[model samples]
Target: MSPARVMVVDDHPVVRDGVALLLRNEPALVVVGSAESGRAALERAAALRPDLVLLDLRLPDMLAPEVVSGLRAAVPAARVVVFTAHGDHHGVQAALDAGAHGALLKDAAVTDLVAALRRVLRGERVCDPRMVRDEDASRSAVARSGLTRREYEVLRLAAQGRTNPEIAETTGLARNTVKTYLQSALHKLGARNRVEAIGKASEAGLL
Candidate 1:
């Protein structure tokens, strides 16, 4: 069987090149292409048709979820595995919800990265063990806080620096409704303002 054709998508030149070089050294994988941004990744995915994409969670042009969505739309057969330095549960969850096949931290061992990729190729969904622990802790905290899913969603958007109007547009809710949700979240979180609410929510992993 032929080696898996992989594409590395990252904004940092050193990281992108390094990952590609490492994957190239593996007999089971081949570096087919690399892109610096979400847009470029989509373009290259369309043209190169890589079997898997090693994607960064944060890119200059777009976030992980948006990029994952685009890649799925552009190449439905290609598997996406987020390779991010951040352990941000919200971002990772969003990308996974958008249909990414797996996620791994940049600090993971080279062997772990290769093994995760191979597992994904075999149709397994893998997430870093550390990330899974973090996610579980976050969910427990959120549960303890008793934040409703909508409230959590609104607060999460606020944490991302989105304005009320922007959150409304994204959630298909009226501005007034968004404000009401935010206020309720603030009250529950015992936060005096949006910034404080965001901080508190983040600490509690409600964001």
Candidate 2:
């Protein structure tokens, strides 16, 4: 059989290069194309029609979820696997909800990544087993702190190491508004800082 065609999308040059190098070494995997932005990935996907896409969550041009949706819309048969540094349940869930075929942390071992790619190509759902269980358990937990959608977005971005200014850029919210949402979310979650707020929100299933 021909090698499985794959495309990698990431803003960081090093990451894209490294993943390409790794995949090139795999006998059954082929690096058909690689892109530095979500928009570029979409355009390339249209031409290459790769079987799989390894997408990063942090892209300068578009949010990872948006990219996932666009890829799915453009290439219905291609499997998009999320490769992100944000291993939090919120990030993972967002990727899955956006129709990603698999979600893998950026820090995962190369061997694991190879395995995940193969599994996804075989039509298997790939995600952290523990995170899968956590999602189920979190559903049973009550969200005592009633935060609005914007507040949840702010909190989730904060957990991903984004500052107020960065969050504002990502969500198109004012910096002051992002700050206000963070403060309100932290208070409702009974958290002392962004980290604590993320922990609390994750526990409450608001994340």
Candidate 3:
């Protein structure tokens, strides 16, 4: 069988280099390329056509979930393994929702990382069971938020740093209505302000 082609993506040079080194030691794996940013990773992914991608959860240019979503669309055949230092429920859920084939913590042992890659190659899902429980709780939390679907869209745009006028323009809602929706969303999310609402919503996987 041909060796599995892999691309390593992380902002930290040391982390990226370490992962590349580990993968290179495996005879069944080939380190095709490494990238330090989401943009660069997307470019390299298109060029290299790697069979697997080791993606970080945080990049300077994009969120890990956003990057995973983009890469999956950009390269449909590549298996994405999310590797990140963020072990919180929100982080894991975001990675999975973004279409990661596997989710692994950065603190995982080299053996575990290798196994995750192999399992994903074999078409198995790889993530902690805790992630499942977290997702369930998050779903319940979002349900209780009681926002309409359009309100959810508004909240997401706001989280993306859009102003009220911008959200109104994008959502085609009046500025006052947009403000009202945001305020209502904030209350339902139990947030005191825009930043907190964004944080809560993202944690609940509403973004």
Top lDDT model: 1
Estimate every model's Cα lDDT from 0 to 1.
0.84, 0.79, 0.79
Query: Model 1, range 1-207, lDDT digits (tens) per residue?
Result: 999989999999999889877776799999988999988998889998989999998787666666787889899999999998977656787678668999999988789889999999999999998775466777787789878888888887775556899889999999999999999999999999987876676556554
Candidate 2 or 1, higher TM-score: 1
Candidate 1 regions with alpha-carbon error over 4 angstroms: 133-148, 151-207
* Candidate 2: 10-residue stretch with minimal lDDT: 135-144
Report residue 116 deviation for candidate 3 (angstroms). 1.3
TM-score of 2: 0.66
User: What's the TM-score of every candidate structure?
Assistant: 0.70, 0.66, 0.70
Residue 178, model 3: lDDT of 96
lDDT score for residue 144 of model 2: 42
Task: Tell me the tens digit of each residue's lDDT in model 2 across 33-145.
Answer: 89999889988898999899999876776666667878898899999998888666455676676688888888888798899899999999898554553554444443446
* Candidate 3 lDDT score relative to the true structure: 0.79
Candidates' RMSD to native? 5.4, 8.2, 5.6
Q: Which regions of candidate 3 are displaced past 4 Å?
A: 129-150, 153-207
